[model samples]
Target chain A: MLVGTASVEALAASAPTISAWREQAVELRGVTCLQVTAEMRRAAREAVLPPALHPTIPAAISIQAWRVRDGDLGAFDFVCCRVSCRSGVRARGFTTGACASTERASSGLAGIFGFPTRTATIDFRQGYDGADLRVEVKGKTILALGATSPEPMGPDDVQYTSTLNLAHTPNGLRLVQVEAHHLASKIDRLTAHLDSFDGEAFGDARLRPYHVVSASIASEDISLPGVRFVCRPDELAFTGTEPVSRA
Target chain B: MKFGIFFELSTPRPFSRENEWRVYHNALEQCRLADELGFDHVWAVEHHFLEEYSHSSSPEVFLSAVAAQTRRIRLGHGAVVCVPEMNHPIRVAERAAALDIISGGRLELGTARSSTWTELGGFGVNPDDTKITWEEFVRVLPQMWMSEEFEWRGKSFSMPARNVLPKPLQDPHPPLWVTVTSPGTELDAARRGLGCLGVSAAGYEEQERRTKEYHRVIQQCEPVGGVVNDQVHTMNFLYCHEDYRVARDIGVPMVTAFNVANAHLYWTREAFPTRAYQTLGNAGAAMKAKSRPADDPSAAKGLPEGVGVGDPEHLIATIKRWESIGVTGINFLLNAMEMVPQEQVLESLRLFAREVMPKFRDPGDRSRVYAPTTVPGFVSDPTC
Candidate 1:
């Protein structure tokens, strides 16, 4: 992790030792965000983590993008994002496999937490500050880090939240449904975003309803008028100073 | 096709007294510039308690100021709310007549039934009854303008036989128009022979369907004004630069801000639960919002595939699409939410005039600058 963390069990004798750990809080308008961390004090207790995975810090992060378009998934129209942070810290966009793979999910520690739940709720306000707005994604869903290659899920391959809704069919099939908010339009913009399995070890057993979410605000110059920049992820750092501004 | 400018007079947060004045005067300056740029007309909305969405509550006064500053560009109420509760029909007639006279008959009288709960409730206008009231108001308005001593006993207002003084300079009245936001309103505008002043930022497909419906229906309808002003004037955003990317970069945020602010005023049964706005904001406008990406942080924000917010070539192609759809004119919302600076707005207008206007503007012979003197070829002697 970017910043070191004390062991939970080591704090007191009453608690048992655990190698893997994760924590997050995502209420954007309330100025809160998800912070994930995984600590390993002893190799014996940290067996849950995938092999060859290590923690990374979110030292500097850049504003990647925030949008909610119509999608085929049942949880369509929720705000979601791919927040790229320094030192290889990628936020949520995990699939059922990543959430189950505690080792790989916690491998990239120290990132943001977000709620990509079934419910489509977004309360966003912009221009309260000179160039800043507030976003709130209340409610709950699962959080995890997904690695495109089993190479310890870096920041770029991870996602902050998921907004695609997965429906449990009568035949026990969890099929992706059209987005809830803009149902008529989302059907056209749907893509199979969950195909980034990367030969992981877990079956699709951890598929809770999938939901996507994103928080976007436009400012008039002083407030991030957000001129469109086709700058690649690397170029973002050159074009803009990676501000630690959360929420 | 013709072009014009429309305003909601939106300003940014931390709105001070200074910003309000600046918004008004900047609009006047823009109107003056629009006249200089040969834009056909300039229109402003009449709204109340709309916070930052629209501040132009008194269109007559605003148009008066605009008229005094500009010489050629026509001024319109883009429209005036015609509910009797908000404005007595007689008063609307008088005010419109006065403004028309002041502007030397260069007035387009656009009328509307209140569309937002904030305004309908503020004026205590009944949504279900507003349509009837507006129909009565609009029908009677023309009579009030044309009749020597008008007398009317209607559901909304009853006036004794008294002259509606200061009759409009136009033979019958300024060309009539109505805000066509709801689905059937365009047909209603056609049936009444009024121009469709569409508030919805409809897409090309929708506009084409509606325009076709209007043109076909209006041909078989009776006239509402002195003569049929069968036209379609739709709303759109305008931002032009040599570079298409540069134009969108500036236009997108402004367009998004305008849409968001507009949505706030649109009453949904869930948010407001009011009959006004038909328990929903303009259906077409809402669909327009739905058609657009809810949040597009990228610079490609403002106009879509066929919108008047890009390079001259892009705008020309976009306008041709609208023209092919049978749209007669486009009213460009030059600035909103203070997203684009005043200087940027001026530059955009100038660029559009230079690059886009000439393609569509007819180079026909000029009409008379002034009507002939009362006694043709008569010379007045200084000695007399």
Candidate 2:
């Protein structure tokens, strides 16, 4: 998992209060940072989505599999990948890392709900309040999880929060906003696939599936250079030191 | 002074709920108007996945629609990216021939290897291999067009040649044009004995130099296709109105948009590291925003100095400059980036036909303008 964080206050400042913030959130929903480390181990490796819908979806369904040995990482890995759809049309290649965010969000939602569930459209707006990160996911509410003891608390504490704000607009069920914080450890697992598959695939490759082995919410304040986020006095603060923010 | 109106089928502001359909119908109307006005050609570009800059990804379908409506105006592809990933050689030859037959021999094939990374990487084409693939496709196209049964085994593309159907009406084949943006490619086009379609945005001096080089190379050429070539055509931006300032005000934005969009789609992809070509979505806007005055007459800005905004008189002056530079045909870009209302474009065409075309269409002027040169030995048909 590749864990990264961006300042929510900064994002909010950059985005407009009404339309821009909501649009930015939706745009952020497409962010991906995960990488795959295993190839097709099962024959019934159906593409995650229907073929007709592949053109519009964030993740590509078709992929070529390859094997690689990562001496630096000290692991053997298998990967499935395809050229980005946008790049394929332009006849060029450049792998974008942010696509994994969508995959992680999809998988997390799928785990909480069930398979073959209709994807609820969600838009996330990110902003920074001082050093604290603020993220809002707006859309149709499907599944909402409340925080349990020992489980980390998200902003609204429906721990697995899925809120769909349909009543806000007359056109239809458009996402409005749901605020949250970036729990670094939880995000680390959400984004783990990004690192595991990097060295395993050559050239442009599709992201690998997420394998959530373990996840924990840090309760202590963590400090890193060039980063400042305020945690509740008793609550844990998760800090990311990487210069680049994948989400 | 032959006229060809350009259509990229762009959709500007107020993208209606049914914007796509409106744009398509609008383009067809423009083609019909151009045909009615006796424009010599109607050229449509082939661009994929570019939202507003270009919506006509399927030029074959669009051209066929135009072919059904227009009578005299030649139907042309500003380019069909000859790289195999975008289209196989056999497919290209077959489609071109079909369109030719459908258009009653009014088809002109303009071949190119696309410049943008968005197209190259999107189709999983290796940039290094595109040139080879294009060369192979171009070489095979003539065979597909001329032979009853064609078979070829090439390093990049291979096929057991079968009878390709709907042979073109133009004797051996249709007139061949290779679209070129650079001087090197112009020379290459000349060496292959193919007609040079100098599609660059360079000023008249640079175009003159490139056209001179093309003529020089054609003089000592070895044909790459099945037949030799005789003429070179250059594309220029032309919007004519009674009011020169109105032409500049309205037409300049569209022309500038098209040039910047084309360049951005082509150049910025090279800067990034990737396996598939993707558009630098912001690059076009950034380029347009950073635009500066073309004070330098000799800069390689890809546009002729006197282009963009002009009246018929101004257009005549520009054509005179191009004529002095030895361009055989002047392909005026009439409706660029879908700017200029259809009525306005038709008005511009009608005005040019009345004011500028008459002087160039005179027999005396034609004879003085088109220089006679000996046909190359390999020409299958010297009539063109």
Candidate 3:
């Protein structure tokens, strides 16, 4: 669980003009599965009717279990949304349910309604020119009535880490429990299976089920940064480079 | 990997109403040829009120016509805008069901939330609400198709319990897909167990990563439809030729023109000044101003780097790379900005089928394979 009070900063003075990427680290409060499932609609209803002094809504919300880039990290996606607080203090970070990858983020988010805490923060680093992006979530007093649907692993989902919850508490809202389930995914299997292709599975393997598809590399004259041209024997020379989000 | 063709139905500058007719007829002719030449799918995009960039607003009508003309090729909605403001849920289901029945169930329904401010605002769709509306629209769309009589009361709409007619020929309805342009949408698509229709002209490196990520995540994705269509289609440019240089010369200009024309669209950021446009404009190539390159055709002789736009060898190599990366399908943007003459586009399709398709054929087609020494007006690899 990636939670707790947190502050983190990373700067690389590669070049004052530009650093291929800048020191783009900031703290962000996550918009929980609860907020997405409830608050938006409730905000709409409150607009239509009277504003509830204590807005309570029951929701059986199924969170799109966000997969991490690695163990306890952000998603493979690198998108960011900059949020500004009432104090005019602004922080920018990836707009992903990344913090949901942990029991800590769930508990901290749950703390907002449960304990009525002033603010809770956490530290996480994205591999953005190797810099840390920190986020601080200010607790909201709006009471919600709903239990988060337990995070269930998909048909072939592989669970490497933890889970987050959105449980309604008499105190407010708290994450009931976060646990790791059993379901090894094809993604995890890819990492394990990529190097084992011994060229024995070429022609027959083309029709094989549960395999990744790719186009052969071209561009003889022009060199691409991380592309390998497929040789005649049809063997792969993979770069093992991770894809970065333009986010 | 499957090979498919895409159409935006662009009518280039220096034309009037006659060009629109020419564009549609030319596309129909192209589709006929693709159907005969053994292409997999003919995916048409849905765009509204955009001049030159895309003239295809009514995909069902166009696809219905294509369906009547062809027999084998799969009919796909590159995406039908899922925002209720743009298209009512029942209408999409009815039309898709009708098309599926008409086309003998060769329908792949791809859905999306309107991105451009032009389409969204034009149809009175709130930019902020489009995502939620899209989610609701997809969730209930299947219910409408599957249930003989369906009723829905949600944030988006309220439809009384009534029989939605014309059940699809495909059991339970057509395969559902989501048009993904924004980064990280693949995961959402997987979570809902929908196909990832990558509309962007993302390079192979990016496509490879996306495909890998998709296959990885989709295994555990919860299905939004009746069943998961665990497929990924990478959109690309296709202008195949006998000569590598000729293919490069013809295809690159079309790509650049298409990109430039597409970028000129009135995004939400431009009009509303806040909302989707700001984030997407910075992230997409839409904001990049483009100009017509000088008349030196050699200057335009190179294909879009990391795209399938060169000669047979280049395309073969590129398709092979994408196949190796685990892309289940390759969606080729056949005509862009109307730069390529219709005759040339048809010839390019024929040439691609002749030279490139054979390389990826199943084991049964080994007898038809083109040998290395048969240059066939193309440059043979010196390395070979």
Q: Lowest-lDDT window of 10 residues in candidate 1 chain A?
A: A183-192
Candidate 2 C-alpha lDDT tens digits along B22-85: 7777778878877776666777777775545567788889999999998777887768888878
Kindly give the number of clashing pairs for every candidate: 36, 72, 26
lDDT of 2 at B287: 37
Tens-digit lDDT track for model 2 on A46-123? 121111111211122122111111211121111123222221112121111111113443332222211111222322
Ranking the candidates on lDDT from highest down gives 1, 3, 2
- The stretch of ten residues in a row with the least summed lDDT in candidate 1 chain B is B365-374
- Per-model TM-score versus the true fold: 0.58, 0.57, 0.56
Cα miss at A89, model 1 (Å)?
31
Off by over 4 Å in 3: A1-247, B273-278, B281-301, B363-384
Model 1 spans with C-alpha error above 4 angstroms = A1-247, B266-279, B283-303, B365-384
Per-residue C-alpha lDDT of model 3 across residues B44-124, encoded as one tens digit per residue:
999897767788999889999999999888999759998887788889888999999999888999988866655765677
Docking class of 1: incorrect
TM-score of chain A of each: 0.21, 0.17, 0.17
Best by lDDT: 1
Cα displacement (Å) at residue B21, model 3 = 0.4
